[model samples]
Target: MQIAKVRGTVVSTQKDPSLRGTKLLLLQLLDEEGHTLPEYEVAADSVGAGVDEWVLISRSGHAACRVQGNEDRPLDAVVVAIIDTIYLEKRQIYNKREQYR
Candidate 1:
């Protein structure tokens, strides 16, 4: 799993049947310092994360496929949770309440 920020949404008019109802999101991976990385990925949204929100992602296809209703979906990543807060070394690095306020 990795921390990421939802950058945007991905829309595909034509896609595999298994992905028909899945919500795809564009995400930029975040470093330990909460800085965005150059790498980007499109991941299925299982937790309904919104753009600009910090999220937890499962990058393993096997783990992503384990999400309910995505059993056999062709997905390499998936948003597992919408992050509420992050703490490192006893110091708070991110707080969703403060970020949105």
Candidate 2:
């Protein structure tokens, strides 16, 4: 799994039937240290993630497709969790709880 930031949403009027009712989100890849990378991907949202939220993503084809309960779907990435906090060693690096407080 990789850390990513939900940057935006993707809308499609015509898409594969297997993707119907699935939420597509634009994700900005992030390092373990909470730094943004130059890479980005459109991932299927399985955990109801929202923009500006830190999320856990599975990039494996099988894992990605499995999360949405559609193993045959053409998906490369999927949001698995909405991160509430991130800590490196003894130090806290990120806290989603603080954002809403």
| Global lDDT of each candidate | 0.92, 0.89
lDDT of 2 by residue, 1-101 (tens): 88999999999979998888888999999999999999998988878898899999888887876764757788988899999888899989999988778
For each predicted model, how many residue pairs clash, with residues at least 3 apart or on different chains? 0, 0
Instruction: Give the range of the ten consecutive residues with the poorest summed lDDT in model 1.
Output: 12-21
Q: How does candidate 2 score on lDDT?
A: 0.89
- Top candidate on lDDT is 1
True-vs-predicted CA distance for residue 8, candidate 2, Å: 0.5
Q: For candidate 1, write residues 40-80 as lDDT tens digits.
A: 88999978898899999999989988999999898999999
Worst 10 residues of 2 by lDDT: 64-73
Regions of model 1 farther than 4 Å from truth: none
TM-score of 1: 0.96
Off by over 4 Å in 2: none
